[model samples]
Target chain A: MRIALLGGTGDVGEGLALRWGYHSSHDVVVGSRDPDDAHAAADEYEATLDAHGRDAKFTGFENAMAADRADVVVLAVPPYHVADTVEAVADRLDAGDIIVTPAAGLTRDDEGFHYHPPSAGSVTALVADAAPDGVPVVGAFHSLAAGRLADLDADLDVDTLLLADDESAKDTVAGLTEDIDGLRALDAGGLANAAEVESLTPLLINVAQRNDDLWDLGVRFQ
Target chain B: MRIALLGGTGDVGEGLALRWGYHSSHDVVVGSRDPDDAHAAADEYEATLDAHGRDAKFTGFENAMAADRADVVVLAVPPYHVADTVEAVADRLDAGDIIVTPAAGLTRDDEGFHYHPPSAGSVTALVADAAPDGVPVVGAFHSLAAGRLADLDADLDVDTLLLADDESAKDTVAGLTEDIDGLRALDAGGLANAAEVESLTPLLINVAQRNDDLWDLGVRFQ
Candidate 1:
């Protein structure tokens, strides 16, 4: 399957790009507002994979072009940019194609980081509202530690919770998620539960901050 | 410290009573609206500890009586009853006493459970508002798997995020939490972060419902 990482020049996008490039045979493409930046990120990710002795189908393009070529498109941008990113690629998304959102809105204060969701209830919901009809929007990877995900040396024996109304699209995304050896995906019910799933990101960050030894903490459900 | 589990006849209350009785030297007390029920639960908890050959300080009383006798009083009732429970025992609370709330408001439908926080933002915050000044309110254990907590055979190799504006009270609760084997307590900042922490409970329940092999799931941050 082909996968596009929109806003793939950023932190979380970089993590997903490198992980897919290393672990799966899928064609991984980086998408950015600036195609040059996307191309540069794709090259950097490909070089990292090459160092690990894996030559994979990794490339980059403008957001819409990437969406056009991909079966699954990930809006890996920050929370504020999620809707605009989806709108930018709206015309390119075809029926049966899946749009996955991993972004969560958060605001930081002197005390700590708090889950600051958008008016639509969550970033995933915001993306859902902006995307064209017939395209399934799945919420996953909302609470992943991007730094840990990018580090191939890290085992990532953690789980990612998934939320979507469409079963087929959810399953398709879940399959892609497990292609990376150590990560497991569990169904967390429908799109209405997006707020709860997205909030876990900031909660995890707060927990990680107060604990001295833990940085870039990922969650495991036991 | 004398720890009172208000509404000790319930699922979460029973779990906490048993765990504290078996794991810590703190005097564990069961409090219910009906004193008879409290006494019965206390007897049952003591019986469980006796079966395992451990002698511990365990007892029960009416809600106000329990609050009067204890340094830390846990409002272990359901979300809707939290404020009233506090009001019922308001006069019994003394200065420097602490009230802990493990409750989160949730609504369920065909899909699964959703976090239905009170207008005050979170159950913890509501409890804080209802609580009299000088008696600190700390939020912890909002996401514990009750059945696993009640079962002594199960190892609680998990973390509980704590929220409180009172640093000393938070420290006290953290110390009490670590007394239970395999449970780690991480500071999740002040009570403002309570909504995010509270939402995790329903999210976990939703995930557990969809995944057959797992039920009563607890989170561990890695």
Candidate 2:
């Protein structure tokens, strides 16, 4: 399957692009508002994977073009950009295609990061609301450590909680998740549970900030 | 230090009663709305400890009486009853004493459990609002699996995220959390982060429900 990571110049997008390019044969595409920036990121990702002695399958284009080329489009953009990105690429998304969002809304204060859900309840719901009809929107990878995920040498033995109203779409995303070695995907139920799952990112970030010995924190359930 | 578990006959409350009795030398007390119910739970907890070849320091009383007996009072009650429970025990609590709440507001439907935090933002915030001025309210243990926490034979290698406005009181609760075998405490900053920490409960529940092999799931950050 082809994957178009909208806002692929960012931290999370770069990480997912590298991981998929290194581990699987899927064609990974980078999407940005500026096609030139997307192209540069794609070249850099390819170089990084090549340096690790792995075959790289990566491409770059504008958001709409990238979305049109892939069956799975990951909205790897910031929380504030989720809705706009979905709308920008809505026309390019085909029926039965999935849009995945790892964006978690948070507000930082003197104390630390706090979960700040959108008026629609969660970032995923916001994406689902803006997405075109028949295009499934799924919430995933909301709690991954992007820096660690981008590093090929870093060992990832963590679980990613998945949420969506569509079971088939959820399973497809889960399959992509498990395709990357060491990442496990566990279904956390429908979009209603999105806030609960998305809120975990800030908690993980807070714990990681306070605990010096622990870095790039990832969660596991046992 | 003496510790009291208000609403100690319930799932989470009873689990705390058993764990503290079996693991630490601190005197553990059970508190209930009905004194008779508290007494029965205390006796049962002592018997369980005795059967495990452990000496038990367990007692029972009404909520107000229990609060008066301890420097640390844990409001291990349901989310809806938090403020009322605090009000009922307020007169018995002394200045500088700590109140710990593991309550998380959640509403369940056909889709599963969704976080239903109060208008105050989180259950911990609601608790802090109801608690007396000089008394500190700290949030802990909201994400624990009570059935696993109650079982002495189950090996618990998990982390608990703590939130509090008072640094000294937070340290005190951290010490108690560390007292339990295999339980590590990580400070998650001030009470503002409570919603993120408390919201983890429903996420764990939803994941546990979907994954058959996983039960009584506890989080470990790696």
Candidate 3:
């Protein structure tokens, strides 16, 4: 499968690129507004995989071009950029393709991080609204820490909740998630439950901030 | 410290009463609308502790009476009953008392469970509004599985997110949470973040429903 990481120069996108490139045979494409920046990130990801003695298929392209060539497009962009990013790639997406969002609307104050969901209810819901008709949108990986995910030496026995209105799209995303070795994907119903899944990111952040030993905390269900 | 479990006949309330009764030296009071029901629940909890060969302080009382004596009162009622339960005990709470709510507003359909947060933002926020002046309301244990919590043999290396504007009250609750073996409390900002914490419950339920060998799941941070 071809997986395109939109905003591939960013923290989350870079993490996903390296993990998918190193752990599986899937084609990993890095996407950015600037093609040069996307190529730079893809080179870095390639070097990291090389250090681990893994050779895999990897490429870089502008966001639209990357989406056009991929089976799954991951909107690994920041919360503020998700809607615009979807709009930029909408024309390339079709019925068989899927868009997965890991973005969560968040704000911080003197107290701590809080889930500041968009008017559409959640970032996933916002992405669903912006997606081209018949192209399914699934929400996953919202609670995983990018730093932990990027660290190849880190053993991730973590759970990533999946939510989507389309059952086949959700199953496809779940299968892709489990390809990363220790990551377990659990079905969390439909997109109506996306707010609950997105909100977990801030709670995990706050927990990591307060505990001395729990930096870059990710969730496990037992 | 005297810890009162209001609506003590219910699942969450019974779970808390048994855990506190067995794990800590603090007084555990089971409170219900009916004193007889509370006492019956208390007896059942005592028998469970006796089987484990731990003798502890345990009692039963009406909800109002329980609140009158407790340093910390846990509103273990369902989401719909939280407001009226808080109203019933308001006169009993004073400046030094603290109220903790674990209620999450949820509605289940054919698909799965979805978070149905109240207009007051969250059940914890509603409790905060209904609480007596100077009596702080802290949200904790919102994500814990009652079945897992109540099972003494279940090893819970789980995290409970605490949210409250009152730092001292949060500290007090954190201390109480640590009294239960294997449970760690992490501060999750203030009451404004309550919706995020409460919403986790429904997501957990949905996940547990869909996955095998994941029944009565609880969360751990790594």
Candidate 4:
């Protein structure tokens, strides 16, 4: 499947692109506002693959162009930019195309970090609202750490929470998420579960920060 | 240091008991509402140590008795039981004896799970309010999953967030948490950060539940 990562120059985008390029047979494409930056990141990732003696299938393009050509487009941008990014690429997204969001609207204050869902409720909902009709928007990958994800040698037994109103789109993204070697995609019910999934990231970060020697904390359920 | 597990029969208690017993010279005490249950858990844990041929010290008692004898008491109960449980054990606790809570209060609706801070604010604050005056309450281990922690074979490079108003108590618990193998401790400021740390668990669970194969999802920082 053709997968385009919007904001592919960011930490999460790079991680997802590298993992798909190295471990799966999918054609990975990097999309950015700056095509040159996207091209540079793509080249860097390819070099890392070459150094590891693996075949690389990755390319770079502008966000709209990438979204226009890809079967799956992941909005890997930050929470603040999610709506604008989706709106920027909305015209290029067509019917049956899946757009996945890992972004969660959050704010850091005197009371540490808290979920600050936008007027649309969440970043996931915001994406759904921004996309054109018939383009399915599925919320996923909101709890994974980019550091562990980007490392090919890192053996991850991690779970990625998925939420969406659309069942078929949810399944498609879930299939894509699980295909990357060690990841498992579980149904966290639907779009209502997005806040629960998104809020975990800050809590994990706080735990990792406060505890010594536990810098990169991960959860594993029984 | 003397350490007490108020809910030693549960997953987190078992993990803490095993790690501390195996790695530290500290005395480990198992506590439960049922004295017999505490004794049984202690015996089972002792057998685990005996299997490894490591003679680490452990004992069993009722919750109040265990708290009475310990320097630090850990409330390892679920979020719902935290307040009543603390109230039950309050008379037994004394000044300078620290209490720690790892519970995150959560509410799940059609829209997913969220950090449902009581009107009193975060769970840690709730715990502190329930405790008697002069008893230092600290919040740690808000995001560490019981499954990963109980598995000795799992090499978890994870973090534990520490939140406390008292510097000395926070430092002490921070040292204790890092004493466990492959766990790191971080200073997350104070109890103000409790909501952020506590909220991570449900989000992680939601993510784990939604994904295929990603059971017991965890985080690791870059």
Q: Which candidate is the best by lDDT?
A: 2
lDDT of 2 at A107: 93
Model 4: per-residue Cα lDDT at residue B83:
94
Per-residue alpha-carbon lDDT of model 2 for A1-222, expressed as tens digits?
999999999999998998898889898999999999999999999889889998686789999999999999999999999999998989998999999999999999988888888999899999999999999989999889999999989999999999999999999999999999999999999998899889988888889998879888899988
Q: Write model 1 residue lDDT over B95-123, tens digit each, in one string.
A: 89999999999999888999999999999
lDDT of all predictions: 0.91, 0.92, 0.90, 0.82
User: Comparing 1 and 4 by DockQ, which wins?
Assistant: 1
Model 3: per-residue Cα lDDT over B104-172, one tens digit each: 999988878888889999998999988889999999998888998788888888888899999999999
For all the models shown, what interface RMSD does each have?
0.9, 0.8, 1.3, 4.5
Model 2 chain B: lowest-lDDT 10 consecutive positions:
B197-206
Which stretches in model 1 have alpha-carbon errors above 4 Å? none
What is the Cα-based lDDT of residue B168 in candidate 3? 98
List fnat, each candidate: 0.85, 0.94, 0.85, 0.49
The DockQ assigned to candidate 1 is 0.84
In terms of lDDT, which candidate is stronger, 2 or 4? 2
Using lDDT as the measure, name the better of candidate 1 and candidate 3.
Answer: 1
Q: Lowest-lDDT window of 10 residues in candidate 4 chain A?
A: A213-222
Model 2 stretches astray by more than 4 angstroms: none
* TM-scores of chain A, one for each prediction: 0.98, 0.99, 0.98, 0.96
User: What lDDT does candidate 3 reach at residue A169?
Assistant: 96
Candidate with top DockQ is 2
Residue A206, model 4: Cα distance from true site in angstroms: 4.2
Pick the winner on TM-score between candidates 2 and 3.
2
What tens digits encode model 4's per-residue C-alpha lDDT throughout A43-118? 9999988887787967899999889889999999999898899888989988999999999877887646666788
Error of 3 at B95 (Å): 2.2
